[model samples]
Target: MPFDEPSQIPRPPRRVAPDDRPVADRLADIRARIDKAATIARRAPAAVTLIAVSKTHPAAAIEPLLTAGQRDFGENRVAEAQEKWPALRERFPDTRLHLIGQLQSNKARDAVALADAIHAVDRSSLVTALSRAMEQEDRRPDCFLQVNIGDEPQKGGCALPDLPALLAEARGADLPVAGLMCLPPAGLEAAPYFALLAKIARDHGLVGLSMGMSDDYETAVTLGATHVRVGSALFGARA
Candidate 1:
């Protein structure tokens, strides 16, 4: 479900109930987990940001979480986000959007226009394109250099050897290089990969680590993940 493969875009799994109460409670539980994980790691809970990945969910399914005081939301497809977020943003002006999916260089302008942060800037071409768009449009979204930490060929990260250069390029372009992101190979022990990403960020003197998803976010928190993207655990199974 990595962002680069659009043909394999994840389909929504199942419909969640219309009731808002569960959504409120669900967020509270997630917040508790985040707090516990942060405490165990001896880091302040407020240091980590939880981004509800509302990829395939419509605005109705998303609003309850917003009402629960979840301000940061993430989306995979720019087009899908375009369809849903404008109305929602009109209603909730403080909502911050993160592009937690792979991005194409061609869509740089739109991505720059829509996202508060882009968590998938892994290549030089994208850095150049995004820099131009941001300059022309007067928008500079925070950028994360997605690393193929597991060295998976199909993933959208800049390979390990290329990360430093890419980071340097992103900085050179004046794109706000905020952090490093990765998708450790699914079903494997994720801690090592998460640890590796944190180390890379440290080696590069970067402050953010956008690792973890629904399954292993707590483990990631232990290893210093600044942002964890959760969808199913907060919203229920996709339809």
Candidate 2:
């Protein structure tokens, strides 16, 4: 994807889940589960980074979690994050923003400037754009190469066959390739996928494994996930 010409990536339609809860209680429950999973795996409780996915929620919805001491949050779209995070960060400067959705090469600059880590870097053109963006913006965020572990056609990750070359491309461009990221095929037992992603990262000498979400984060933790993105479980349903 050498200079494929950047274009705007449309945001997906919003789908809200039902109900909500006190962020503190929900956050506490999620952390307790994470700690239990980590202990079971003989991994340190501190080894996992819990990323609260706050994509469609409002600033007010997020404030409680911030006050509750969650430092890392994830957004699915760059535009939404740009609009939301600045004011939030103005109030709480220590928060780290993560871009956890399919990113367009066009938004690479904005993502580079805003995110502390990008969890979806799958193509060469995105690699080029992000590398340039980091240089021009004078900010380099950690990157994770998204692998379509289940090889789903409608998903955002790079196909398994393309990963090695893509990794090389990302590194050659001086993108700080932190590790691999993936989304298992939905509605399936996700353990195999998580294990596969961990193996891929291990094979590459990459330590970060950005897998797991509200439903299967514990399984992901058992498989060596360094980061778990939990949303509904932390914020109740979406609302």
Candidate 3:
């Protein structure tokens, strides 16, 4: 059950059946779930920040959750977030935006301007781009070095073998690395991946672990996820 060995990590307990209810009710449920998981892990619930992934959903769709007091949110694309969040942030000035998708080097400036945290800092070129952007913008968004936990080819994360070098490069450039992020391969038990990610973060003395989505957030919480990117569970199925 040691975190370093993903295969030895036990499968997460089966979650209850989905709750089909209003947004506020679902939001409450997810929070309660996080609290329970954190308690079970002997961690404080406040340690987990729930990031409602607002990608693809329109601003109108996001407002209700904002009204319901969900402060942190994640978006995939810089342009979409640029178009959707400015007015929303104007109203809810405390809202923290997280860029949870792959970021292009070309969009580094925009991402630095918009996101409170940039979760997919994978490559050396991107680290340089973001560092330069941060200097120009006078903003240092928390950067999470994404580790391809499953080593999947199509994923947008630094391979496990490459992480130490990438982490060094990012720190050498002074990219305020908050922690690590990852997406466990879909349709499999997620605990092992979460555990693996937790191990990596601990190995590097990083405190932030931004893993978990709607389906497996509780497991992520129990495994020490500081930030959980939840979308469908909060907003319902996307079109």
Candidate 4:
């Protein structure tokens, strides 16, 4: 009888180990949810940017997420961010930090130094301060013009009608206006407001749209959000 040929070797499927589960697992879970949401919107998952909101959460929490390949983090309070950024930066040098809080004119200098981008430039005074601070520090921080989409008196954005003038002033002062940010009214549909901000940004030739949060980021992404600030969803409920 003729000698039988040796059988070809069989390859085993790769397995994800338990020790490698935390970060990648968390990221995969979040990405899956985002994908489902995008499908509902009839858009690609890449259309939305998930900005892991790390405000109030310590560096301990942030490290795990970073290890899982998360590069973008958002902080709401300038003071808190200022205190946390140095250590975080030292640890994760490549991470991008965003200041998603209400920025004050007084904190412009420090904010410029700490944040890769500031998402709350809503007033002429604040813009002027930021411009001066950037000149003084010789560093121009990327910024967005926050619009009071809901026009709620208690909110911290410029009124809808005032955005044009504010944009003009920011441009005049040499402020780098990257895009627009907004907080939609609570208990109401946010899509309209998000759409309005998107329109305004497009009209001004701006690109970034930072909107939505833990509760409604999917909707924001559907509405063409370039950046979504998600805190509670990633970090668990706020304490």
Highest lDDT model number: 3
List, residue by residue over 71-133, the lDDT tens digit for candidate 2: 999999999998899999999999999999999999999999999999999898899999999
Which residue ranges in model 3 land beyond 4 Å of their true spot?
1-5, 8-20
> Which 10 consecutive positions of candidate 4 have the poorest summed lDDT?
1-10
> Cα miss at 31, model 2 (Å)?
0.6
Residue pairs with backbone overlap in model 1: 12-238, 12-239, 13-238, 13-239, 14-238, 14-239
Task: Give lDDT tens digits, candidate 3, residues 27-55.
Answer: 99899999999999999999999999999
Instruction: List the candidates' TM-scores in order.
Output: 0.91, 0.91, 0.93, 0.85
lDDT of 4 at 99: 91
TM-score, structure 3 vs. true? 0.93
lDDT scores of the candidates, listed in order:
0.88, 0.88, 0.91, 0.81
lDDT of 4 by residue, 1-239 (tens): 11222233332442222333465575767678778887888888887778899999988888888888888899988888877778878878998889998988999999887788999999988988999999888888788999888768999999877888999999899888889999987667666777777778878899889998877777788777888887766777665
Model 1 scores what on Cα lDDT?
Answer: 0.88
**Which residue segments of model 4 deviate by more than 4 Å?**
1-24, 35-44
Quality of model 4 by C-alpha lDDT:
0.81
Indicate the residue-level lDDT of 135 in model 2.
Answer: 95
Kindly give the stretch of ten consecutive residues in candidate 1 with the minimal lDDT sum: 1-10
